[model samples]
Target: MGRSPCCEKAHTNKGAWTKEEDQRLVAYINAHGEGCWRSLPKAAGLLRCGKSCRLRWINYLRPDLKRGNFTEEEDALIIHLHALLGNKWSLIAGRLPGRTDNEIKNHWNTHIKRKLLSKGVDPITHRPIDATDCERSEEKKAPRCPDLNLELCMDLPIEMQQEPECSVVPSSTTFLLLDYCRTSLQMN
Candidate 1:
């Protein structure tokens, strides 16, 4: 069976919210604060669905919301956050006080994306647009740590193993031993 609807869609008002509707929403929120969105419309005497009321309050009517054009610092911050967080708009919005997730997402698509492209940066990867395929592939590959030995050995322990006459050690082992010695010397 299909899931039940959130509200009586036939009865609720649609299209652009009137000024009175906005005022009513604001007054109701001011009186009772937020939450109980499923019943908010009934409580507020609004003809909007609970979802609509919640969205209007959050995306437009919220007092703490920062409206107007984004600042240069905000642009830089959004880019940095997007690089780390990707398309997680809500998480990105959390880092930026007063900015809503919807607002940030819209700005990213409408402005920041074009800005990045104009500067030769790929908005998705946050890398140079002209970067070679080899360079891109290199970024995808795991970095090698020459001094770290991750090989699993099923043989006997070094102490239990019979030493060869030549006592030759693997290159990786030699590199690790050298790194340890260097670290020890540096610490001392």
Candidate 2:
């Protein structure tokens, strides 16, 4: 049999939340601070499941949310992050403060994925559209992507090439490298 429901579905309110529900949730959180989700509905005197309450509080009613359009920089960041992390939306969302995973995932599906496809890119692979996807000749091989088998020989002195003494490794550079390699893959 399928897993049982998380809560009593018949008892709790579902669908869109009302203004009073929002107010009550916010007030309860403000008065008591965040608590265990399972007990939250009962403690807050809400006729909603803890999951529903959590979603409402986090995705919509959170005061710290920077509601509005995602900036151009945000868009690029999301794309780059996706290329590196795939659909690990929570990790991507963590990098972008004020943006939720659900929001980013929806935006990607509805906007960025289509945009990349329009550019002849395979959004998931972040590479050019495969030759097989088109009615192209099998004899003519798909254009190969850039290979990084060769060592990165920066014209820097040996000292500069060495790892820094700092504890924190710079991840941005690594993320960009992955993005570059993935983007260079030929679609056709």
TM-score of each: 0.69, 0.66
Candidate 2, lDDT over the whole model? 0.79
How well does candidate 1 match the true structure in TM-score terms? 0.69
Candidate topping lDDT: 1
RMSD of each: 13.7, 14.9
- lDDT by residue for model 1 (19-132), tens: 999999999999999979889999989988989999999999999999899999999999999998899999999999999999999999999999999999889878776657
- CA lDDT, every model vs. true structure: 0.83, 0.79
Lowest lDDT sum, 10 consecutive residues, model 1, at 158-167
lDDT: worst 10-residue window of model 2: 158-167
In model 1, the number of clashes is: 0
Candidate 2's residue-wise lDDT over 51-168, tens digit each? 9999999999898888999889999999999989989999999999999999999999999999899999888767678666454433223333355432232344522434312232
For candidate 1, give the lDDT.
0.83
- Any runs in candidate 2 off by more than 4 Å, and if so which? 1-6, 130-137, 140-188
